[model samples]
Target: MGRLPEAPLLLLVVTVSFLTGPDVHAGKILVFPVDGSHWVNMNLLIQNLHAKGHEVTVVRTATSWYVKEHAPHYRSITVTLPQAIVIEEEEFFVNFLMKMLEIKKEGVSPIGFMKFYWEMLNALSNIHQQASRLGVEILENRTLLQSIRDSRFDVVLLDPGLPVGVLVAHELKLPTVFNVRWITSGEGHFVVAPSPTSYVPTSGFAATDKMCFSERVKNMLFYFLNTCIDKLVVCPHYDRLVDKYFGPDVKFYHLLQGADIWLMRVDFVFEFPRPTMPNVAYIGGFQCKPSIPLSPELEEFVQSSGDHGFILMSLGTLVKGLPTEITSEIAAAFAQLPQKVIWRHTGERPGNLGNNTLLVKWMPQNDLLGHPKVKAFVAHGGTNGVYESIYHGVPVIGIPLLFDQFENVLRLEARGAARAVDATALTRQNFLEAVQDVLHNPSYRSNMRRLSALHRDQPLRPLDTAVYWIEFVMRHKGAAHLRTESYKMPWYSYYSVDVCCFLLAVLLILKAAVVGSVWFVCFRLCRRRKPKQE
Candidate 1:
């Protein structure tokens, strides 16, 4: 046959590939957000997946009072446990451990140490057992599993903070991906596989990796011991259930180790010093939907603020317990500013009020940020709030308190998008200066706008990318190639230097054995000759 023109041949191949591409027949995906704000970006993904003609179902758990306060109107299937059950269980164990550490620090006798070990292990085991039992009860009785089966879901997308959802994904023999919204020391950051580099220090806390060798060893030992306790007390129950539902040989870590992909709420540009993993993708600021309308009150708050726009102060949901000193410093800063300030103060304010400052129990954060009258965000750098500020191209003064907040703020500072002022170091003077810098300075706003462009410049919206990958997992049965090699490599192998040393030791042992045998044989022959002469 005569050769076709290059353009026609290329077109024919492209047409065929497009028609037979892997994503054409994506399977049904069930997405369950453990908490509601997690639902914000997740819902967008679910909506996009449905729009893309893929089968997607979202199973949600409803508000605890916490969720109600922060994420009202979020869709979920509500269920109630006894009040404070999880918190009580968690606190008791936390206190017990704290006490144990105190006693150890005081220096226990050998006998006392042994006794303490036993008591601590037993208590920890019991706590895990209780949590596991509760997990089992919920999974079996809650109709969550049944709903997944009814939907005939081929895969489950889950948030690991909701352990039950992780457990259900295991039971169903479904490929799973994690949508991580925050940083967890235990699980590492969502988009990046666990790395020592991802460990960032909180303001009052010491650096995670800067510990002395002995301290690192001790922490590693504690982690190891804790994992053993969890494996002993908790994992068996879930693993057994998974085996019963799926197959005899399937394991819980297989699901954890097999996490197909992670759609992290982190943008690489914003989180410097981040570790990368192929199975993980950075899609931070995914939660910030564009140009959403603002409520009238927020609009009015913006409009009433004269020529200079207002500043936004929100400490986020977790740290409602703002220290009086911090609050006073903030109030002092507001008093000097020409701008109006909106503060999301959770509790009753002491009689101190500046005329320019407005204290609200809650203000619509996204709405306020979107407003043109908002000049800067004075924030705690919670991932959601930080991302939102960047999304709106507003300058920030980050007063980070905990978790990855310090690191997030540090990255923003490095980007010139924000400044990280230590909450503890905040004096009334410094606070005012920082606020003025963010507001009056063009550099901070210019930096923020640059990042905002980079954050928004994805070929696909974060939601679409997230949804495409969820469907990708369904289409490829987990795209096992996309899985990181780190998952397969043992710790020894991952640090190749250690592996090489180990191999050298083994070779030395073999060499020593051969040398010793030859020497012994020669000595024996020499001894035999001497004896005969005698």
Candidate 2:
């Protein structure tokens, strides 16, 4: 009885077609994610790609549990682990936390730091060998390699945290994009940009952008040491693996140097000022999403706290199984607060736990942080936890435990949004005071709200930016044009140290010539006056 006008109907049809028709941007994508938190972080980007109609496959390792649980539909090729040498998730985390505690106990003197560094390298070497073996297994499987080749994937996304992804990308002969879950490392930075140690501090040191003389010296030394460790210990293992699986034609270092783009999980708001190349895209809050409604039990618990609000405390997944004594101290601190506490604990319940505190094995951290009833977050200062708290405008009480955590918490502390306490020195009074300071102090909340606004004020959301660049790389085959010429230069040349040396050499040569000419003139004068002198 009633038909729409032809012009309006045509407009509606065109809009519908644009929205629902086959995606012109879709590409076949292959991802190589390191296990645990690295995989969890990459899964967010993977989900976005999948939703955009891109075909994706992830090569899963033994440490991958989150990917299987979260993105079960995405295709995966599991690397089999030998039963004799299998390391369970619980065991791995326990060892990691123990090492962290050891480092905390033994202060970071130069010698002590070197000792710890060697130990870490040894552990990493073991893991690298395991990952290499897995890579070899995958490549040796002719059927799998044939299928992957036949799929003709457009590009490979990799987490360079471990070296497996670099090997896989090279074997496939695909354009590579490195997805790192922390501030870009020296290795990652050198691949696509210049990382000047003069201003750009390494990941772990708690130095600001403007460093004192001592701090800069330490930064330079650490940068050099870390590079040596990577070259001597890490890269050689990867080289052997590449030679074994792919052949000597392609080296691991070459793969890294040729990376098309680096999807770094960092933002200028949170990070100190540093130079980044065009190929280095900062997707800081890519994992952060609009808060989901909390579970019924969590809602009730949080709502019961009234205007006093509650605090959310978690050390993240990798730092579980802390000592019971430490947990007891934390519990005692929480008991002193008027606000209720939601603590994520993996071990046995602390005997001194307060009535207002609730301990759970896991919690939806981001959703709880977004709740109005949540006032402050007590966390281990991991990048993910810090970003989520900042996204929700929740102030933080940071207890830095391990690598990069110290640096992250220090930045937040500098910004007036957080207070940090050393995990080794954490006492009931100190912890309670930190919690009280952030909750009662209006400045912390104000700073956090400002940061949250700044973080959210962007032309495009971080996820969309990440996806656009990912697709851009696929569309262009490789975004090599965006890469800086610095990537191809040696360290000395890139920093102009060679130029300085050449100038010094020229000055020395000129000085020597002047001295010789003066001597010759004095000798000739003496010879001409020799008879009169006699």
Candidate 3:
């Protein structure tokens, strides 16, 4: 009577075990995100990790608005970077506009373009030096370093755009995962998968994956030039700084190669076919969210436009604000459209703004794109913005500014999902016409919708896939086995060029020996015949 039945006892044991299963293991993650849009993009992943109960500590140049708002949730270490090094948006925009104006006025010439290119490279070098200085400051802080060591983070996440992040990971003796917010570039060729210049378009260039003979030549030349600049100007400064901070034996390139995974913010649907290593994961649209409800005011404005629909305009965070002249031209173009306009502006209100236009400091871009009344996006063609537009199935009039924007827009145009107009060449009439074409034409919307469907049809959400891979690396203590053997080989050896050269040398030696033997045998036979004749 006192003993329980065997089946009942087994059931009780199983129930108790189910109720008290092992707790989800939380990992300590350290993230190094540089200032600007990269940090903004990184916040999506960081927030997700925090939600999953991971302890995350981010080292940033300055606390972003998001971090400031959510400061209590995670630890943020802010490094005070010099104002001179921190590129002021106003000054940068003024200089960029002046250069564009000069180029347009003087007309495009090979010499003029080369001069501008070098000037751009110099500017980039200055930024790289600033990043190095930031790294030095962090390394010099003994208290911070000691705290990091004590924390014993499972993995260090880095933005490889800033080489100092790689140095920090090296100093911590931790496995690294690079968070690249765009397609693979030549700068990280030594670390990530090999993106050959033959088909893989370089980051900033305006060539598609399929290029003509002349375009391929130009692409190769640009790739070569960028590599030279990185090695001669960029890497040396970073290498020296890393050597000074971390031991002399710690090379920046070696630390770069130590990365276990590359989380690239690109998708195959939008990108061309290319080889990717197992360690590289495509996490495009991780930041993209399902359309949330638009604010009442925004909804009212868009709905009031009726059948004509509306256009959404934004240049993203990097450009902070826009010039008055460009804004005025944009306003003028909007005035002509039957459709209403919603412009996200950080600058003063344009005097020529149409009665139908709504201007605000910030707008819910993805939501606006999802709205049925919205028709076409006039954007700066940033990769994030492009992905969002594609996600919502909206056509685009891309006003490419800098960096990968040009190439992103070029791909969109090739896919028939968008049209690109150089900012320098954007007139009120052309801008209006482009907007009208995208709206009136049916192909743009169709192509975008098709691509949007493809993008959304993934087996798992992009963010989940990303998180799984990240934790997978942590579980393995670094997925070193997943890294391609080519990552460890020199460039020449990776392509078998060295092996080819050795084979060629051996063939040449064998050919020379064979010829010598034939000549000697012929001479001996001739001499013997001559003696017999005598």
Candidate 4:
């Protein structure tokens, strides 16, 4: 019997070896960078993927600095679109519709209807451009796609902001992985684009359920308007393309939902608790990787500061050159601080800078955070900066400008790792108070160090986790199981109360019908009994 089974045994051994062997499924990944944030995030992903033994080719919008920095040695292709096309405009309409649909309690009005009509037309023009750009991206990248298919891409890492990447992901049948560089509303609308924040809930913007009457009504209308755009405009456009290749039954969002992974730049520790889909993985600290050496000027600046130390100030790249009133107040705040203020000011150094204060246009941020003399950080609380500070265990004084800054600061404050100063209502007193609170408070520093330990103490670095999961999705044929199926539920399905209310309404209808029938029967009986007298 043992000798007779030799062939089967050999087959079993071969199957086991094939299943467990190293490099069983070597595959390539297509990376896209449609914006500055995309460029940076994608560049880092490329580096990590390359290090983890995966082949990568980058496709990006032209003139990206990240291409210069990281992907210099790798092959890079640019997305081509006409100048008239704008993606943000489509985003606005998509946002407006979503907000309108989310809050059904507060209905729409005549003025709102008129405003929505104008916005919808404007949004329609944008959608036309977006569809046009997507077509152009396909045409330009046709040869590139052919090459990727020839080489065999197991999965596509797409930037969801751009329609081109999603279109390509669908075309290739490779599992798509989304990398979000900005804070997305739990609903997925980006807050940075020219749209009302009412529909989308991110860290800084207030959630829909919590808004006042007027704002809630306004946002609800916008959400309804956005839902129409998503259905009529975005969904239809995607459906036409997807159905052309994937068959008529396939939906655009369904295909997107089937994506392998969604790596959001968010920390639950820093954000509010909202129900999340399984496929949506929050790898927020990806940008918090330890870095190369600091710039010579920044290193020297830190070294020059004595035992009193320095307070570092910066408002991200976009809003660096702010209004004069704000700058004056910031300067005033610096003038009051006991510590030396090494400001990364993008404008001229004010004549009234404190004796201890020094102004420089730019500094290597991570390097500055790593400096022993850097006592506190004043940042816009951009995800990148917050994580960098957290990575180095430095307390932060947040002056949030817009978007999720408030949320970021709130999270930090809740954790006792930072203090917040509102940029909109900023004054010298508030600025000075925040600075003192961050620098002088031992609790902030202690909590920061504790969180830094938890963040840094991961079995593998965030980059490694990101790269590994991406390849895992590719190797597994598609990590379809990791995707959240919650999208199948309609807008109403998200709320359990809605489901209960629906059941309750059905019960009430049945009860009322039964009671009416009983009453009718009783009346008929009474008429039959008294028929002669009538």
Best candidate (score: lDDT) = 2
User: How far does residue 251 in candidate 3 sit from its true spot (Å)?
Assistant: 2.0
Clash number for each model: 1, 0, 0, 18
Which 10 successive residues of model 2 have the least lDDT summed?
81-90
lDDT value, candidate 4, whole model: 0.66
lDDT of 1 at 301: 65
Clashing pairs in 2: none
Q: On residues 458-484, what C-alpha lDDT tens digit does candidate 4 reach at each position?
A: 666767667767876877877777665
Give a tens-digit lDDT track for model 1, residues 7-110.
99999998998887653564577665544345455666665666667666554323232333223223344444433333223245335534543563467788
- List the candidates' TM-scores in order: 0.71, 0.89, 0.90, 0.74
Clashing pairs in 1: 266-284
Q: lDDT of each prediction vs. the true structure?
A: 0.67, 0.80, 0.79, 0.66
At residue 275, give the lDDT of candidate 4. 53
Candidate 1 vs candidate 2: the lDDT winner is: 2
Alpha-carbon deviation at 346 in model 3, angstroms: 1.7
Sort order, TM-score high to low = 3, 2, 4, 1
The per-residue C-alpha lDDT of model 2 at residue 92 equals 64
Model 2: per-residue Cα lDDT over 36-82, one tens digit each: 67766888888889998899998876555565733544787776755
Order candidates by lDDT, high to low: 2, 3, 1, 4
Which parts of model 1 are misplaced by more than 4 Å? 1-28, 36-39, 47-134, 142-147, 181-250, 273-275, 292-297, 319-325, 424-427, 485-490, 493-502, 506-534
Compute the lDDT for candidate 1: 0.67
Top-TM-score candidate index: 3
